[model samples]
Target chain A: MSQKKSSEPTPLYFVGIDGGGTKCRAELYDTTGNLLGAGVAGAANIARNGDVARQSILDSVKAAIEHANLPPETLASTLACGGFAGANLPSASNALKQWQHPFHSFYFTSDLHTALYGAHDGANGAVLVIGTGSCAAALKDGELTQFGGHGFLLGDKGSGAWLGKQAVVHTLEAIDAIQPKGQLAEAVCDHYQAHSATALVDKLNQANPGVFGELCPIILELAHHAEPTAQALVKEGCEYLSAIARKAIQQSNGALVLAGGVAHALQPLLDSDVQAKLTSSTHGPEWGAIMLYQHGAFNQGANA
Target chain B: MSQKKSSEPTPLYFVGIDGGGTKCRAELYDTTGNLLGAGVAGAANIARNGDVARQSILDSVKAAIEHANLPPETLASTLACGGFAGANLPSASNALKQWQHPFHSFYFTSDLHTALYGAHDGANGAVLVIGTGSCAAALKDGELTQFGGHGFLLGDKGSGAWLGKQAVVHTLEAIDAIQPKGQLAEAVCDHYQAHSATALVDKLNQANPGVFGELCPIILELAHHAEPTAQALVKEGCEYLSAIARKAIQQSNGALVLAGGVAHALQPLLDSDVQAKLTSSTHGPEWGAIMLYQHGAFNQGANA
Candidate 1:
């Protein structure tokens, strides 16, 4: 129950965002819960680049507004809540909080958090995100417990980035003649036109996780074709995912939601136990974010 | 054999630099080959940071001139040769070459090249470099062949960065309850004051290789104390080094030189065959750089 101006209580609107490493998605809805518009924008992993993330958020929201046929000023009366990858870092979160936003108010949390909320319909459950990066979380009662979502530098074992980087690693080994490279190495080499270790190093010295993650399709394809190196990489990923999925299930005693860009591709590859615990989401993270905004707004008003 | 003005053939001073991931080292010598002065500066991995590398080259050279009790303007008259890490990357190399250097001439090459030149006194031999990064090279019959040493992200196995990163990876696994935290993990925890998984990720979200590499001392100490995790990391590194060292030995048929900041500490741990090929470096990379410069200068003049 938000305090309203008695003179003229205009209906409010909401926008929910799922800001990820690869892209930012936004959903705009009116007070009556009608989805008016959806928009997508660029990478918004706040931990990596606050400037880019801030711009991405605004861009996505603006695009949603345009698609919804709303006036530009509508943003001033809209409530916004979003989950962003890399906002788990306090510094990144603080940086985003300090953004000069156009919305009436903005609420934010980790990308994984909102995904969990959506997966369980704002109830208690668990989720394992497998995409450019990987991580897992379980909600028990009201508390959220997370496991194995350490960023890229710390191994996100099942992540697309991890698999892609592994391809590079073994390619280097192959180029060094330390091991006989498999089909996967050759595929990666061909992708980058990197016939030698020095050449490969030249191309990727300053590459981000996304660049490495671009090799995932090849890895997944070769793995499907029974390429030993590719299959081995996927297997290693499955092992990590299986461990975390089992833990999430045990800790929360709830169904686990598998999500993210690479989720479906990896879904069938998951262990039987993990598969058994898996469930489909009732709504996407954007919808979940709108729910979060409503709940947060209500609490603030009540506390006041 | 360098061309000279008829008015006066200037007796040029020389400064040789070994620009590495951790530090930039310079050795100044007169034409007579007498060591005049030496200086040290900050990390100069050209691929990671060209501006820093460029500044480091100038800074170290200036410091050496000061140590030689030479005037500040001596930099203009000094012939400089240096090997810098990350210079193998074409972009980094081009960037360095583009710098408006104050030297009489600045000649650049990979840090490994200078190390190999120093190791065998500019003769045909192989050198395995194991410091904050690792790589091996063999030089014979005017052709230099390189092995391993892609870089930190691609896995420079057994390098300080590699060992330290493994500690973090294992520590994260331990905190995630995926595996038991070993002594090395605990040591890493104490160093970063990161008791939980989130705290560690927050602290290291933007950390460079040097930050992780700082944990190398702890890892090395733990390995020395027989901590299984630490020992395993060291063993993994040694395995890589052994493989590359064998290749270098077979290709060059020359003595192998173990060098780098971590070289001495890891020397005894190497396989016996690798040890058998080991020979003392006749000079450091700086001295080797001087040899390279003199030779290059000669050839340049001869061609002219």
Candidate 2:
């Protein structure tokens, strides 16, 4: 018996969502993969904001669909993929999967998953993210390996948060007379208007990742000006990043792609060998989210 | 005033409270310096436990008062001094001061303050508390200066929690194939039954300072057994501790006294120079609390 071709919706269009601790971004594309529109919303880290994460994601996706001037029903027809913070955790991923989205097909993965995918274009390679939080991931064949990203408590070494935290620590030490005040320490004190150890500590106790991250550039600027303490912190941070990158490169035997706002500032401090092996990434994690469906990395489940 | 010597309280007895994160200990003594009794209760870190800290402290002190077999009215006659965790924080100390305790007088200070006083026996010196958390404090001419002990996030450098944290970090690295597993890592995995990197990360995220502190002795035992990784961690811990101790000693220009359960265990790991400068503590923080009255550190206010 010959099966006749039936009229079916084309699976040529896709939506990508990159969810972060600070904000979420969603983008839509057409059959030719031309840029359609993008939308931004608040934080979508499920571990941090819980149920709010779901709403942040929905808002971004809906805004993206509207901005593209597409029919609202198109959101239900298009394939959607997302990579979000804390998605690696079973509790987080399971909760996210239970969300009843209008998309024809939905896929979810960890932010690191799309990061490595976007950085290396689904090839065996390594991607280092050094934003407010840091993580190093390597994709070898299909298996993914991670070195850090243990959150602020256990790890996130060489991250913007780490740098800022170190700066604050040094400032406290200086205020306590344990260490001499340097340019970075002075700037930190000036930033918080903390002239004593007690005041500095009080300020630090109330600080979150965002507040700490704001000090990263100031510390890096001191490094650029050749301040000894700042140079030491930058050197130490780069060393940690280099070590993780080296391990990922060794594991994957592939290219290295660095991401995040702090990455460029830190790259100059990396060892010559690490710098030599670095490669540029053409797309962001949002693009990688869409690529996940296109490359079959994101499962279609019963929708297929 | 000399004519009104009839029917007055002697103000001869003293109560000393040494408050910690995991427990609050109280000791009672007479004017002759004879130990009357001691009692222990739950955590008393006001910054972490809030109202619970006050309850724990009261329970411990009440138990000690009872154990001392003193008259109920003695509590009102006794001079009391408390060295509590987070006492340096104005909010915590201020709240504590508002409590109406049955004491002739009350004094408040950070745990480090009492630790230093106890270790030095009221003399100007330096003390290093290397327990679940680590801190170094120097006392010179009635001035107390502290270094480290900014808690797990910012500092607490050469502490049980820090060592345990390092072991877990190395375990994660080994699990990820970033580093080879060592004896310490093996023990950590065995303890948590974590056979994979993901499991290790999950276990680490759920662990608190107390949980991490439980692992310190295991890591230190491995160090004593000459395990390379454990030795490395111990070496690093000693270096950090030594730096702080050195600065405190230099600042105070006095003898060094080591306190806390982890202190004696870690003494063997200290550099010969730091070890040479160490001196035996004549009294505990309870004694220091008593001495606060003798030294007139506690201000006498209306019973309110």
Candidate 3:
């Protein structure tokens, strides 16, 4: 008996997208749950990048599909889920949903949700993300509990941006003779090529989170070498992160993960009690996004 | 030999200007230095306000001259000095000097310098300025030492702005269920009309220092009622100010004054040790500007 190729909406392809203020990442997977390809593009934060967010997301998704050696038409049959920064805002999420996509079905979630999912391999656990920004979330039986993702203006207490702000403040104090100049403070002044407090202030007034975050590694390095100011900043940041971890733990099953670009740098600085509770994430956010496509609480909301 | 108006220059009048981020004030005085009249106008932080600073200064100076019943030409015969918010910055001071003021001579000094000078009547002492922003400075042997005036981003550790930021932070935490919602937090949410954490975050992300500072009074009022979150924020602010006061006292001759719009509100909240060191200001910043014209360190630097 001769048979034609099956074309009954098989959902053969799955796509997972992770979007943030700095960049967007997408991954493509096969029906066998095998990772096929991944791509990255510029920022996809709807509230910040505006209309460009849609283009960035689409570009990243197409890049991943092309990388996987799939026909362009396969994108129409893909089941997709995206966890994005600013997705918690209804206005931002609604605007994002307005963009046309060829996916068989799509679901949206906050980046914090994806991070928590990836950290524990879809299990009930907690995660603290301390990078350019800071936030903490816990998962309990498919429900999410969030804490302290209030952005740089209101909170992000132990974030890279917070540490950077502290470094700048200390550097300015040193220049003004309010504080003693240490190696770390001197390094910060040198980094900005600031010869005077005025110059430093002017430069810092115009700096964005990414530029500010560049100082984080410098400060952490100084902390490692025992510079007083850097040491103090690190201690303070760790304390705040510890507070976040404790709260997250209360909402979870006590499986905690510190996950972000800046997490490892801050790990050793945390107190012994907090250090003891941290576990390595089972999979990256891309895998978590793929899993979310298949079975995420967001799907229930979207379908309803 | 002044039978008629002499063409030769005469220091018949003195003018003093106190410039801040939000407003500028000018006072006119007779040759013997008695206050004649005062005028106030818009913002005058040259670094931040640009050319508008010059206009604000001119408006206040003209107003003061008019109030004093002096001819417009009297400005040319006046020995004028100003202590402005960004006077420490070379570009700002230089741009200020470029303005074609009619003063016989002009002097520039930092606002902190004026605050310290006015607080002690030009007698070596210290002042903690706790207004929309915070800074501490001490005067010793005509020299000034400053602390914690790095603006909201860098420092201003115990300012109204700092307190406001803390209030917003606590409000966000309450919304996320990480902390309990008290009256102060509820007030904040009501003030911003934020029904959700995301709304509050979005509003805060777009806020400027002035808008944020508006929340300070609300927090202070709530603290007065013994609201837990507001009380904690006020206590934290006081501790930082106390630390600043301690540093200022070290550089001073034990004479300390609490100055600025918010100083009185925070005065009673300080540690007893800090309160014990406090002294009343002999004059306001406008008088300090006039004293600066006669004997400020700025004169020595300018003449050099």
- Which candidate should be chosen as best, given TM-score against the real structure? 1
Assess the local accuracy of residue B127 in candidate 1 as a C-alpha lDDT between 0 and 100.
Answer: 93
Q: For model 1, how big is the iRMS in angstroms?
A: 1.1
Point out where model 1 deviates above 4 Å: A1-11, A297-304, B1-11, B297-304
Candidate 2 collision pairs: none
DockQ of each: 0.75, 0.33, 0.33
Q: For residues A1-304, could you state the per-residue lDDT of candidate 1 as single tens digits?
A: 3323335444388888999888899999998889999889988899988898888988899899999998889887877778899877777776776676777667788888888888898788899999888988997875677888788778689899999998899888988888887787788889988887888889986788889999999999999999988899999999998888788888889999988889999999999988988889988999877786666622222100
Q: Can you rank all candidates by TM-score, best first?
A: 1, 2, 3
TM-score of each candidate's B chain against the true B chain: 0.93, 0.86, 0.87
lDDT leader: 1
How should the candidates be ordered by lDDT, best one leading? 1, 2, 3
Model 3, first chain, TM-score of 0.86
Candidate 3 C-alpha lDDT tens digits along B179-253: 788898888888888867888877777665656777888988988998887888889778878877878888886
Q: DockQ-based ranking, best first?
A: 1, 3, 2
Per-residue lDDT of A238-281 in model 2, one digit per residue for the tens?
A: 88788888888888998889987788888887777778879999
- The true-versus-predicted C-alpha distance at residue B254 of model 2, in Å, is 3.6
